[model samples]
Target: MRQTWRWFGPRDLVSIDAVRQAGAEGIVTALHHVPTGTVWSPAEIEQRKREIATMKDGSPSTLTWDVVESLPVSEDIKKQSGDWRAHIAAYKQSLRNLSDAGIGVICYNFMPVLDWTRTDLAWRLPTGGTCMRFDLTDFAAFDIFILERPGADADFPEEVRAAASARLAGMDGARQERLARNVVFGLPGAAESFTLEDVRRHLAEYAPLGADGLRANMAAFLEEVAPLAQELGLRLCCHPDDPPFSLLGLPRIMSTEADYTWLINAVDLPANGITLCSGSLGARPDNDLPGMMKRLGDRVHFLHLRNVRRETAGIPCSFHEAEHLGGGTDMVALVRAALAEEARRRVAGRADASIPFRPDHGQDILDDLGRQAQPGYPSIGRLKGLAELRGIIAAETHAG
Candidate 1:
């Protein structure tokens, strides 16, 4: 596997030098400033590449932009709504631009409204470090009392709904407002922030589509773009839905193995692939990470190797980001599976034999507390994760 790190461009609290120091061989990033539906100009792409290669002090960092974390798939395209066709054209053009610039892999998700929803940005762990967490009750509270989405209570079980209600009732106005802010909070520096009214409006737009309708829209999108990706030698990987289930009554199409199978078979192309995010998918207990890697290895163009411990036993339960090796997925076994898949690819003489992976989310520890970096992307925490993962890979390689 090619070890990469996600660097949120120039404004990221974590710098390129820091990424290099963390021992990452490649950089995974996106032109975050570019709006969702807009084309990523070749000039903009090249400028980013240059920025990644050159440090703040004009020194060569020698790091190449290895993967595009997202060439964003707009909600317009996801719903096949207003100007969706134009967005699709723009998406294809972005792919072409990325390919022309030698960036062959693009990772994007089709999750409507929010990219990855979390109730708490800094949930304290027993180890005295803090990691991002998603509490089911808190999310339900947001759904029921805060955003007040119609029929929101129907989405949860009676017990869950009651718990959410009780939680909401106890909280003061300040806590409620804070929860709302965190729930709708967007990625820092990404063009995804949303106010409460903005979310309500977006939810209204998605109300008519439901789950099946949304899935069909996603399939239609792949049918148009997958072929172009294949021809351009670009591997377009769809990130699995975070938490892998319904949220705010919106359908989560790419959550499970079956969900992936549906889309992959629908498009039926090599370019149409999966970004097997263990942390996101592992939130669901039934998602066998190692098995999925083995079964879907051929189509997995990118990997996000982090872990989460499920707080409860069910589908829509709570989960928090755990250490890379200590979380739900078996890190060592998953690494071995990845290595075996790479060996198989090498034997088949494939061009992209080595899949690029990054330490997805890490706990905020050591020097990270004072730095106030992006929510889940603490520098030292991710460095620790990368080191641990690198150790696993080394052991696996030696044993192989």
Candidate 2:
């Protein structure tokens, strides 16, 4: 695997020097300052490339901006609503510009309204470290009591609804505001995020667009972009839903293996692929991480290697970000399977044989306790994760 780190431009708290010290060979980033659904002019992309390669003292970091973690697919494109066609045109143009700039892989998600949902940004752990968590009960409280979305009550079980009521009752105004902010925080560096009103309005708009509708829309969007991607020699990979489940009555079209299988077959183009995120897919009890990697490895383009420890056996159950190798997913077996895929690709003389993967998110520990670059991207914590994954890759290679 080729090691990489996600950098949110110059504004990111983690500097380029830190990434090099953490031993990342490549940087995964985007023109986050640019608005969604706009063309990434070559000049803009060139400027970003220069920024990625330069350091604080104007020295070379020697790290290439290899993969685009996301060139965001605008919400208009997802619903095929206003400005949809224009957005697709912009998307294709961006792809062409990126290819011209020597970037081959682009990671994007078609998840509606929200990218990744988490109820707690920093939940406490027994070791005094903190990690991101998704507690169903807390989410339900936000859904039913705080947001007060129409028909939100029917979305949860009676037991869950009761639990949420109790949870909401205990929360004072300040606590409720904090929960609302966390749930609707949107992407870390996004230009804008949802307010309470924004969530309600988006939910109303999506009420008529069911899962089937969203899936069809995703297929159409891919049909428009995937062929262009193939022509440009770019691999376009869709990230799985964060929790791999439905939330706030929104349709989750890319959560399971079946969903990914559907996506892989949608456009029938090799450019269409998967970003195999172990932590997100592993949130569901029955996902079978290593098995998915083995079966879908051929189309896998990018990897988010982390783990989650589910609190219960249920589908919408709670889970917390665990240590990279400590969660339920078999990290050793998954890494071994990735190695196997690399071997097969090598045998076939594939150009993208070695996949680029990041440490994903890590627990907040050590220097992370007081200050934070991002809520989940603790520099020291991710360094620890990368070291562990590096050791696994070494052992897996030796065994192979």
Candidate 3:
């Protein structure tokens, strides 16, 4: 695998120099300052490239902006509503500009409303480290009592609703507000930011679009974009829905292998691919990480290699980010599978043989405890994860 790190532009607390020190060969980033559905001017793209390529001393950092974490598909495009056609044109233009700039892979998600949902930003662990977590009862409390969405009661089981009521009752004003904020926090540096009102309004817009409708819309969007990606020699990968399930009554179209199979076949383009986020898909007990990698390896363009430990066997059960190798995933088996895939690609002379993968999220430990870096992206924690992954890769290569 080609090791990479995600940087949120100049505003990110984790600097490029720090990423270099962490031993990442490439940067996975985007024009986060640009709003959604807007064109990324070549000047802006060049400026970001210069920022990543040049150090503070006007010397070369020797780091390339190899992958764009997202060029951001607009919500309008997702629903095929107002201005969606315009947004699609802008998206194609962005891809052309990126290809001209020598950036080849783009990672985007089709999840409605929120990108990735978590109930807590910094849940404490037994080791005194803090990691992101999703508590079923806490989320139900937010969905049922706090947001007060219409028909929210019908979404959860009666027992879950009862527990949520108790959970909400124990919370004072400040706690209740905190829970709401965390749920809608959105991506750390992306254009989407939401309040309770914004979320509720968006939910209303998606009320009629169930899983089938959303999936069809996504297919339509891809039909337009995937052909363009192929023409421009760009790889476009859709990230799996985080937690891989329905949330807040929103339809989750890209969650399971069946979903991927349908989308891959629907678009029927090689450039249309998967991001293969282990932690997100692994949240569901039914997903087999190594099996998915082995079966879907040919279509995987980017990778987020992290792990999660489920608290129970059920879907939508509570879970927290665990150490890379300590979670429910078989890290060793998954790593071996990735290596095997790369070997196959090399033999076939594929251009993207060594997939670009980043050490996704990490626990807040050591210097990260007080650095106030973005949630789940603490510098030291990720360094530890990269080091561990590096060791595994080295050992696997040697053994092979």
Candidate 4:
């Protein structure tokens, strides 16, 4: 696996120098300032690359802006509503521009309403500093008590509603508001976020388009763009739905292996692939990570490794920033599988040999409290994760 760190360009508090200090040679980033549905110009791509190349410390490490976390799908395109063709064309143009710059992988998600949901952004960790986690009780408290969206009460069970009501009753207005922001406010790089009103409006857009409609939109987008990806030698990897389930009555098309199978089959192109996210898929016990890897390993272009402790009720899961080898996932097996897949790719003479792998969702620890970086992007924690993963990969290489 080729180790890379996600650097959110010049504005990111975690600098390229810091990423180099963390011992990563590659970078996974995007032209974030570029608006959704707009084509990224070649000049813009070159400028971002030059900026990354010229880090403050002048480290000689190579920076490949290969992985784009997301190239936002406009509401027009997602709903297949008016003027979607324009957005689709713009998206294809962006793909061409990115590919022209030699970017290899593009990671995007097809979730309807939300990207990743976290009930608490500053969830305290035992070692100090905060990590992101989804608390069911917190969400329940929000749904049943705070946002008070119509039909929200029906989303939860009777017992959950009682717990939520009790929790809500104890909170004041300020705490409730914070909880709502944490749940819905878009994290950095998450497409367009929603206000409580915005969320409802977004849901209205999807009301006419259920699971099938959303899938069709995704397929249509891929059909239009995947060929351009193949032409430009770029692999388009769609991230699975974050929680791996439906939320707020929104359709989740990428939650299961069946969804992945349908997606790859729809396009039948190597450029169309999946970003295997352990944290997201691991939230659901039914998903066999290793099995999915074996079945779809050929199409797995990128990997997000993190862990979550599933709650019994299935609504909330405690996301722990575990050491790469300490999480619920079978890291060793997964690494071996990934290595085997890469080996197969090499055997088949694939040009991009090193698969871009990053330690996803690190815990906030050490001096990260005052660093003013993106949440869950603490440098030390991710450094620890990368070190652990590197060790695991080394052992796997030796054993093989």
Residue 74 lDDT in model 3?
82
Tell me how many clashing residue pairs each candidate has: 0, 0, 0, 0
Model 3 segments more than 4 A misplaced? none
Model 3 CA lDDT for position 19: 88
- Looking at model 1, report the run of 10 residues with the lowest lDDT sum: 184-193
Clashes of 2: 0
Which of candidates 1 and 4 reaches a greater lDDT? 1
Cα lDDT tens digits for candidate 1, 1-400 = 9999999998999999899888899999999998989999999999999989987788999899999988888889988899999999999999899999999999999999888889999998888899999999999999998998999989899999999999999999999998998888865568768999989999999999988999889989998899999999999899988879989988898889999888789989999999999999999989999999999999999999999999897888899999999988999989899999999999999999999999998999988988989999999999999999999998878844
Worst 10 residues of 4 by lDDT: 313-322
Q: Which sections of candidate 1 miss by over 4 Å? A: none
- lDDT for 392 (candidate 1): 94
Alpha-carbon RMSD to native, per candidate: 1.1, 1.1, 1.0, 1.9
For model 3, residues 1-400, the per-residue Cα lDDT tens digits are 9999999999899998888888899999999989999999999999999999877777788899988988888889888899999999999999999999999999999999999999999999999999999999999999988899898899888888999999989999999999998899888798669989989988999999888889889989999999999999999999999879999899998888888888789888889999999999999999998999999899989889999999966877889999988899998898889999999999999988999999999999988999988899999989999999999999998954
Q: Report the lDDT tens digits of candidate 4 across residue range 191-246.
A: 45678988878877788789989988888888898888988888999898878877
RMSD of 3: 1.0
Clashing pairs in 2: none
Off by over 4 Å in 4: 57-61, 190-192, 313-321
Better of 3 and 4 by lDDT: 3
Single out the weakest 10-residue window by summed lDDT for candidate 2: 391-400
